[model samples]
Target: MKRLAALGWPALGVVTLVLLWVGAALYMGKPHVLPGPWAVAETMFSMRGPLVVAAAKSLSRVGVGWLAAAAVALPAGWAMGAVPALDRELRALLSLLRPIPPFVWLPLLLLWVGIGEPSSWMVCFVAALFPILAHARQGVAETPVALAAAAENLGATGLHLWARVRVPAALPLTFTGLKAGWSLAWMSVVAAELVGADGGLGQLILDSRNLARPDLAMSGMAVLGAVAAVTGGLLGWAERRVAE
Candidate 1:
């Protein structure tokens, strides 16, 4: 019953939203401006093949870019957090870079990579990298010094200390960062695709707009939102497991 209620509320919320949307569309009486839910659903089914391919392409870019960012961020963040001297040296530089929106890099990337897959991947990487790095650093920095000393007294040192003590302690915040980074990566991929891609959900939306099909455009957006929600739910589940 508890589980059912938990699911029930979200389902109810979705139904409410759909009803509101349908009402608004009917009130406006402008299908081009705001497609009804039924129209969007029809568009989704009709464009399933293209939508699937576009989603796949976007997901591939997100996966590769996020992984690359994580690979660099984990160790780099750990080192910076574990070493005050290093942190001090890099903090100013990071502060400068972190505030810059990931899309701002798109133009430079387009020039360098020529509006290709690499540019898209780079944009996603940039979007994801900072949050992951910042969270990782914070996690390591917040590790209790007393715990580290205790581990040391028990003959734990260096890698052993890090693996057994620091890493475990930092797991929660690190996962938080990872989840945030993934969301940013997903958004960045869509933006990148919109700006310069041959095929992607973002491009599909643009194509629909060019062809004056608001229903298809709305359908593409709905699909993107659905995919992101599912992925985010999985990540949240994993985070809960780790916390447990």
Candidate 2:
């Protein structure tokens, strides 16, 4: 009974949204521009295989790029946080690069890496790196001085101090960065896929537009939204587990 009660509002909200969507579609009277839910559902069902394949490809690219971003960000952030001189030295360069939008690098990357997986990954890497580094730097910088002093007194030095004291202290903020980086990476991958890829959710949307299929385009958009939502939720759950 309690479980059913807990589920009720969400179910009700879903139904309400469906009704509202149907009402708008019917009232709008332009199937070509704004297909009804049923039309979109049909598009989704009929093209499930292609959608799944495209989603998988996009997810793979995003995963690799995101991991690479974390690899670079964590170590660099740790170094910058632990050493004030290094942080100051990198500050000017970071400032210049950070303000430059991720997409702005696309042209340069396209020229260097060409239109391929490398270029796509580069876009994702750039998009994911800054947030993680920013959050990580903040996390490490905010570690309590007293805690560090205690660790030093206890004979923790050099790498041990960073490993035991800094990393753990920074975990929460670092987690925040990871979550943000994941989202940014996902969006960046889709954008990159759309711009030049042969196949992906982005490419599917591009194809739909080329074929004048608004229903298909909308379906792709919906799938992208769903993927991002699920991924974000899973990451948040993992963060909570880590925190505990």
* lDDT per residue (tens digit) for residues 19-138 in model 2: 998899899999998899999999999999999898888888888888999999988887888789999999899998998878788888989998979888888899999999988988
lDDT of 1 by residue, 1-244 (tens): 9999999999999999999998999999999889899999998998899989988998889999999999999889988999999999999999999999998999999999988799999998999899999999999999999999999999999899999999988888898888899999999888899997779889998899899999988888998998999898999999898778
User: Which residue pairs clash in candidate 2?
Assistant: none
* The best candidate in terms of lDDT: 1
Error of 1 at 68 (Å): 0.6
What TM-scores do the predictions have?
Answer: 0.96, 0.92
- Which ranges of candidate 2 are over 4 A from the true structure? 1-17
lDDT for model 1: 0.92
Which RMSD does model 2 reach against the true structure? 2.3
